[model samples]
Target: MSNVSVCFSWQIFTMESCVLIILVAMPGVWGGAWGVTFGDLCALKGTSVVMNCSYDYPSGYSVTNVGWSRPHYAAASGKWRLFFLSRLPTPPVHFEYVGDYNGNCNLKIHDVQRTDEGNYYFSFVTTLDRYTSTTPARLSVKELTAIVRPSTVAEGDDVSLTCVLGCPARTAVVWFRDGQRVLKPVFQARREDAGRYYCAVLGQETVRSASVVLNVQYAPKNVTLSVSPPRGVVQGSSVAFACASDANPPVTPTAYSLYKDGQFVSAGQSHTVLGVQPSHSGLYRCQAWNNVSWRGVDLMNSTEIRLDVQYGPTYISVSLEPQHAVEGSRVNLTCSAVANPAADNYTWWHKRTDSASSSPGPMLWAGSGRVLTLPAVEASHAGLYVCRARNSVGEMSSAEMLLTMSRGKRGSQPHLIIAGVGGFLSVTLVIALLWYRKQRTHAERKPAVFGSGLGVRGSSSPATGDQLDAVYANVGTSQWSPPLATAAQDAASRSQRSARHEHELPTSDEAEVTYSTVTIQPRNPSFPPRTNNSRAPQKCGIQCLTLMAVDIHGRKRDTLV
Candidate 1:
């Protein structure tokens, strides 16, 4: 009973509630007329808390022992864990009983942790009954922590800052930059934003995390080029070059390269040339690069400088449009030379050759141009020619070229006349012979079919003392005919009859009725020439025919009427 009185009195003192108020408020809610009092408590982690309590017992009930237990929901079924028990010489290390044997109960807990959050109750043992406070004190513990996602990053990158706690309760998170409130949890980092950063819970301003500095790496920029002795460099003089750029984690010489006329020349931040030629006169440029992380992007800067050098002529050449020319033809000769300053003067020379002599002739002073022309060329123009080109730098001559006269048909009118006459005579002879052979073949193919002529179909007697009109008859004949006479005789007879027909001047109808005969001369010596056995003696030839007209006196008119 003494131990119970000591622990219960401590709980009552710490609670600080008046016992008379509870008794008047609730008359029989305590059931056996015993009551308990406990107020809620709130504290921070790593701090201490005091649970003030008070209680009452009915009359004639004796107390024996007092104990404090924690109701935890961690197990399957809720259970109470005894943390402080009276009758022990001293309270547990984390708990201390600080009240007397009266009804004032106060529980002190030191070095509070996050796990110390729950409801606590005080129980006391009496000789007749056991009493425990139905109303427990609710204790809450809070802790503040900070977390940074991806603490290190490059320039122009995004990061997040968060304030966290061991409990699931939501709270406002505040961020700080260089010990100043930023009021935001997300940070869009740039080169200028590289500094110390931290975070804290809003209500617990005193709690914070260790500061972390952000590292921002960036590529090279603001590239520039410089040259020593900026002007007036001779053709064979020396010169120096330098390149530079600005970047974080300062760019090294190995990251720089030099170019001449857009072509890679060397690798370095600086370069020197000992003997610069005119070929080196062009656009010179330098580039700086920093491709860390190589995002498949072009991260580089460049600058350029133009270099001019003075030089003399280096190459000379001569050309001719028509390398071979004929007599009385136009010709052109040109000389060309490559120099820093172009050539302005030119001269021509000739080398003549003959069947008896050859020599380098006098120089022809042409105009101050690159080309020379000879308009009306002749045999005298046949020679070896050369050209000389001159400028401020130097003078050079071209190789010699030999020009000669053309060998083609020129002047022979007599030979042309003779050839023309000979061709005409040969054609005439061929035509005469072809005509003779064609006549002989025609005579052999037509062996002259013999047929008696048919007189007029109806004959009418002429009237007395009347002038009779002449009648013309057209007779049709086949291609076959009878033989007339020997070839020689026929030819003689044809001549005679042609002469007679010319004298007589027969009409068209009578002349068209001329006889055609083809004779086959027998090669046997005994064969004799055939004779005409008709009633009248007719001209027996291929071109002769007898035509007559009879009157009422039966007189034959042998001539055409």
Candidate 2:
């Protein structure tokens, strides 16, 4: 084993002779073909690190010792100390030698401190000469730190994030947000980029910097207004409107304002309308703002909503098809109304003709819409009808409509009576025609009579001239018998009686008398003889029968004719 002294005045010591000597960098102290190679290293504080070093010395000479040390003093001072040496059995505190003393000069430092930041040097002594690296391996002890520019930045603004090491080193810097790596170091900040962030060196990835929180403030966005009761907003109702805004920092109630038809109505996060009226119905909007922008520049307004106020089912009216209905026919009754919220229910009522009250009677039917139907109309259905309509707002009743049976249908009884009379008259006419037919048949069965036989009433044969003279009597008498009126009436009566007697049937002797056996007939001698051109006297409604009789004298005699 060998050891190096601190100064030139110190004695040299050996493994057996106990000789010690000072080793220093002089103009010709390095041996032939001597060189050193090393790379820069980055180490984290409070952790362990290894500084690897290799050196080339005279090839033929046997190797003796190797050691590592940090260059703490100036190069001109020529004062240096060994923190770790392979020749020594034990290293100094916080320093250890874990490499071969033949050529390897690797040194490990435990619990590295920030003050240990410097260049490290490696030295080796051969049997011929001693060598120390001129270009020492540079070592850097860094405490990673995340630097965020403009600690409080507005959202959508460009920002710079950097990972800083206490000392210079040729290592990459990586950034992390929360526990995940942030892909970009410099980018526009957003509200979502607001968590804890840290940084680490490439080699010391587990040793990270202190966390830094990014505060991204922004103006309000996506402002919206909501209503408590969406439908059936009517009078005497309580309605509430709520405003919501999307902002990094919660929007304060003071930032919200409610407007009704472009006019300011209320403030705060919500507005309430208690016992609302028609005046409250209008277009509504809400606006939100924050301190991030100028006044009236970034204020966000919500979509407008139209509020309608419902009132009533006003002016209800009922209509009837075929204003006048007929019995046993179909009738349609329609009930309609005008309302804010259209009618939701309908009811129908009926009143009888005999009912005295003006109001309608019991409910006939209930429905959900406007139309009502009566399948078969009857006389009982002919009366006043009323309709009622109701909705969420209010209820209303329609005016009465009178239903009556048709006029032609009401006089059915008279029509039936006329039909019965016509049928009776037809039956009477048929009976009279049957009796007339029977009388005509009897008349056709009788035998026809021949002229100039014997004049008879209801006799089968006609009268002969001699028989007519014997049967007839002269009624136009010239002898005075009575007053003029009595004689006239008596003459008429005798004339009709004589005509009737001429038709009377005679006995066998009279029936056998012939014109050849009779004497010459003559007119009455007292009266002038009749001339051929003389017209027969006319009686009112009686047929005149002229009769001639022969006397037992050669002179002609005349009888009543």
Model 2, span 133-169: residue lDDT tens: 7767877886777889867888878878987776555
Estimate candidate 1's RMSD in Å: 21.8
Q: What is the lDDT of candidate 1?
A: 0.61
Q: Alpha-carbon error at 559 in model 1, in Å? A: 20
Worst 10 residues of 1 by lDDT: 462-471
- Give per-residue CA lDDT, model 1, range 1-561, as digits (tens): 233443354444332222422443354634456777887777556556677888778777667666787643334445533344343233357777665445777888776666777788787755545566766788888765556566666666787876666545555657787878776577776666666777665666555555777666666667787877687565678889899886665678988888998798899899998887888788888887766432444456466788866555446666776776655566787877776557777777776666575445665544346787877467777777777777665677777767776755322356568888999999999999999999867744532312232223242432121122122332233333334434334444544554464456545324323322223333444544333333333323222332343334432222110
Model 2, residue 486: C-alpha shift (Å): 35
